[model samples]
Target: MTEILDTAVDFRATMGRLATGVSVITTRSGSTPVGMTASAVSALSLAPLQLLVCIGNHLYTRTAIAEHGRFAVNVLGEDGEALARNFAASKADKFAGVETVDDHGVPVLKDAIAAVVCDVAEALPGGDHTIFVGAVRHCTHRVDCRPLLHFAGGFGALRTPRHA
Candidate 1:
């Protein structure tokens, strides 16, 4: 007989093995800017130029995105690990000393490797998280930057393997 190991801890551990690019999902709540570090972001479609981000239902940023109907995905570079850790926390002021600029009415990290401003197209429930589908309105990138990555519960930079 085969045994099925299905537990929250096990699920988390299993999923943590998958490496993903790090990004900060930013939006505005009223006049205040809000953001959260998210690895659950992904490009959803090409035709409509859409992307999706899964935000926790309890996150204030999630509520902000829904209310404002806009958000920006700031793709972090290698030097953004500290910023990522800060945003991941439940800090009252994540942007205290962080430099940002307004892009499409959303707060975008100035040092981001890339930024994608989007309008909320649809929001769906995903267990305890809200899956937000964004229609990309504007996008920008810095070719010189290398992306930061998250893997096995830690942060890292992408490394190309040397050919033999």
Candidate 2:
């Protein structure tokens, strides 16, 4: 077996170098809407169109998602750094001044590069985080927008590829 090291800082630093797309995960808590900025999302399967998002167990959005049974993944565009920062904060009014629309009882960002509505299929314990496997129920996307990326602890935009 490989030796284990108690180096969370090192692990985070190394993982930060792996570029990831930013997204706002949203769900409803009673009559209130809740959301948070997240990068721990992935497509789990194509046969059944499933996705997974890892959220801190203590987070309000996590609790909301568990209660609501539904959530939306708002994939941020290149210009969504501000939105990402806003949602990343621990403020109560994260949605203030932000435009949104309701879809399947969940709030969806109006200008996301893509929005995916999902029904919770499974909730698995993942250390301090809970991995929610969701089945895609609906989706919308804008092909013209570039996705916002996170790398090295900072937000960035993807460089346009050149074709010969």
Candidate 3:
């Protein structure tokens, strides 16, 4: 048991070194919007226009996503680090002052660099999280914005490669 616990700690530290784009996964619980900052989102399939997001088993947002059967991925812009931190915190209302627009019954963050509305295609049980596969239903973006990124337990803006 001690060995397993140590491995979990080491694994988390190792994964933190991998930089990822920041996003807020939003869904409606009844008429109220629920959201959480997630970096575990990824594209799963192209033919069917599907994506996947992993939500912690203990989060209320995960329950809302499972029950609602729909969600929106609000990919943060370079100016969105504060918003990401806001959603990342456990709170009763992360959207309290955040402006949003409706996208297929899901709340889309108005200032996101990009957003995608999706219908929950499949929900799979992972070790400590639920893997939600979503079939995209809508998409929108702002071309002028640069994506927010996460690395080593902190948020940052993307720096384009000089060679490119």
Candidate 4:
């Protein structure tokens, strides 16, 4: 029989088969912005409008986001790979030359597929990561482009619709 640990390992390895939307989880302390490249964001609630973003609990970004309480999730479109890289680096100057603005005093990236401003409502311990439950405070969208996606540890392009 497969042990519990072995089953969990297999499940995690197979999780890559499930594609997910890519996003950058961002926060600011004064004028300085901090962020992380995350493919782990997911919507959790609709009535109160909540979202969950998984973050490695040991990273600086986790602490920063916790301290800030207010943060934004920037939905990067297919062409925004560069932005993703910039934000994912450790304590890197992610804002250098990046087109962004303080959305109602919260850091929001410009030209995102969509930007969601939220406040940290709850934090739960998820196995290797922390699941941040944030309450949506504001949102903006541009329907012209499709969202960036990730699968099997690589970037993915949007699928085209088929003709009937």
Candidate 5:
């Protein structure tokens, strides 16, 4: 008998089956608005309030958060897929047509399912990415919007069945 680990693609596909929420990680430095879409956010605590966002070394956001010392996780809804795609792409005008406001003087897209403004408490090296642990400063949420969910590298809505 032999055991074999699946390839990265296959493993990634398998993990994609586990639905996860999508968020736009936003920050600003100097006079530029910097943001990127990420699904790697995870709530790490409650007693002291904490969460983590993974930033790739090559992305503009990696530099922005480090310089600005603060960030906001703008949780999107199912209808925000286009915005997510816009923020995730490599372009010079990601925010040109986006409707966002200065949050505590920092840019935050409007109508997010939820938004968490946090200060970068620490940044730790995590393999090929940097794990930014933040201490929440302020938070807000939409009254009745379901958050955007992602799975298998695609957008999805959980098949939530209504109770009888």
Candidate 6:
């Protein structure tokens, strides 16, 4: 037997069960940096080293990435929940008080678990969001950092089960 769920809330609740790594998608508008917290990021290809990020159509980061044709994905560490919340808020200055360094022309979080710079390859419309597919230009990672994760509408960390 199969059951059907026909509501947005049900869809969101079902989707939220799938845990995801958190990342800040950063881009520059002129000389100023803009970014947003995102979990809808994924590697699309390996032959050309490509990745895709889904950005809200109205987000400033989306516009900046479109104009600049470049972006950086900063994968947050386990301790970066504050940073994630800051970027996720609706504010004029999301970068205020945040520590960052310029990577080429994009801003990358200094303490993130990993960062990947990319040049936009394509932009596809997906309902209220735009999917930006990027070709990898540069990437850096820290082996010792634990990734921040999101699931069931909350941030969490991965824990290994203890063997008795």
lDDT of 6 by residue, 1-164 (tens): 26787798988888999999999999999999999999999999999999999998988889999999999999998899999999999999999989999997999999789999999999999998999999999999998578899999999997853559
| Candidate 2: tens digits of C-alpha lDDT, residues 1-164 | 26654599878987898999999999999989899999999999998999999999999999999999999999999999999999999998898999999998899999798999999999999999999999999989998688999999999998885669
lDDT of 5 by residue, 1-164 (tens): 15555887777777788888999999997888899999999998897999999999888899999999999999998788998899999998788988898887578889588999999999999877899999998888886567778977888765555659
Runs off by more than 4 Å, candidate 5? 1-3, 160-164
Query: What tens-digit string does per-residue lDDT give for candidate 3 at 1-164?
Result: 35543587788877898999999999999999999999999999899999999999999999999999999999999899999999999888899989999989999999898999999999999999999999999988887577899998998887764553
> All models: lDDT?
0.94, 0.95, 0.93, 0.84, 0.88, 0.94
Pick the winner on lDDT between candidates 3 and 6.
6
C-alpha TM-scores of all predictions: 0.94, 0.94, 0.93, 0.87, 0.90, 0.94
The residue-by-residue lDDT of candidate 1 on 61-101, one tens digit each, is 99999999999999999989999998999879999999999
- Please identify which of the two predictions, 3 or 6, would achieve the higher TM-score against the true structure: 6
TM-score of 3: 0.93
lDDT computed for candidate 3: 0.93
**Candidate 3: C-alpha RMSD after superposition:** 3.0
Locate the minimum summed-lDDT window of 10 residues in model 4.
1-10
- The C-alpha RMSD in Å for every predicted model, in order, reads 2.3, 2.7, 3.0, 2.9, 2.5, 2.4
Which residue pairs does candidate 4 place in steric collision?
none
> Candidate 2: where are CA atoms >4 Å away?
1-6, 162-164
RMSD of 6: 2.4
Model 4 spans with C-alpha error above 4 angstroms: 1-12, 162-164
TM-score of model number 2:
0.94
Model 4 C-alpha RMSD vs. true structure (Å) is: 2.9
